[model samples]
Target: MGCEAPATVGKLVAVNTSGSYLWEVPLETEKPSGGFGCAPAAIPAAIYGTPAVEVEEGLVYVGSYNGKIYAINSSSGALRWVYPREGNLQPVVGGAVVALGRVYIGSSSGTLYALDAVTGDKEWEFQTGDKIWSTST
Candidate 1:
């Protein structure tokens, strides 16, 4: 499962059905930046929703409040890839869906993204007028 706390970094935690910890992967941490005059000046990247697990591929997909989606190795707890290339921030409040060899997720920036499951390369994006905070169905 994925877990995170406010003002702290996110984590991909693996636990058995009995609730024993197996392993964990730490996510990227962001420093506080000047808000647009209303929001908090500083913000930390965090996981705010559930993760999508592809057991057959041994991968887990999760979105972060920091505007990133990650693919993590289930067995080794290693990071596979992150979406949006780099140096871009698009807070994702929704859970991700892995299907048809793609990862689908929405962002607070009001965009729905389709990314390559293996390389995290963006395949397509659709923009909305408002933030996309709902999970993909």
Candidate 2:
């Protein structure tokens, strides 16, 4: 996802999954700024799930295709923590369902995980049949 800085007008933020970098670009009226502003932030991997979820204390949670979920500082794009899942799973395209301080997500491995919303900690896992693709509460 891309966004402009709320404080600075015309400044843009771009997240690149393939390049694993977050770019900050300042929009200039006179000429092109060459897409430069702040340092590039490194993402966990390709993002495939729900976009970053803004939470309390200026934190943002994002899930990626690397089988890892990340909590990063929204303002600085600094990583606070990451929760890794089983990597061998094919993929999880359904995204995450957050409720009551918990995150629910399903993987192509035919399993579901309940995790702590704030810390990205896994609380439980439920395995389903091979024919099942996903589940919900």
Please name the candidate that would achieve the greatest TM-score relative to the true structure. Answer: 1
- Best model number under lDDT: 1
Spell out the clash pairs found in candidate 2: none
lDDT tens digits, residues 44-135, model 1?
A: 55565689999988999998776778898988889898876577557777899989999999888898889988889999998887888778
**Which 10 successive residues of model 2 have the least lDDT summed?**
27-36
Considering only N, C-alpha and C atoms within 3 Å, which residue pairs clash in candidate 1?
32-42, 67-90, 67-91
Please report the TM-score between candidate 1 and the true structure: 0.82
C-alpha RMSD in Å of predicted model 2 compared with the true structure: 12.1
Encode model 2's per-residue lDDT on 77-106: one tens digit a residue: 666666673333334445666677877777
TM-score of 2: 0.54
TM-score for each prediction? 0.82, 0.54
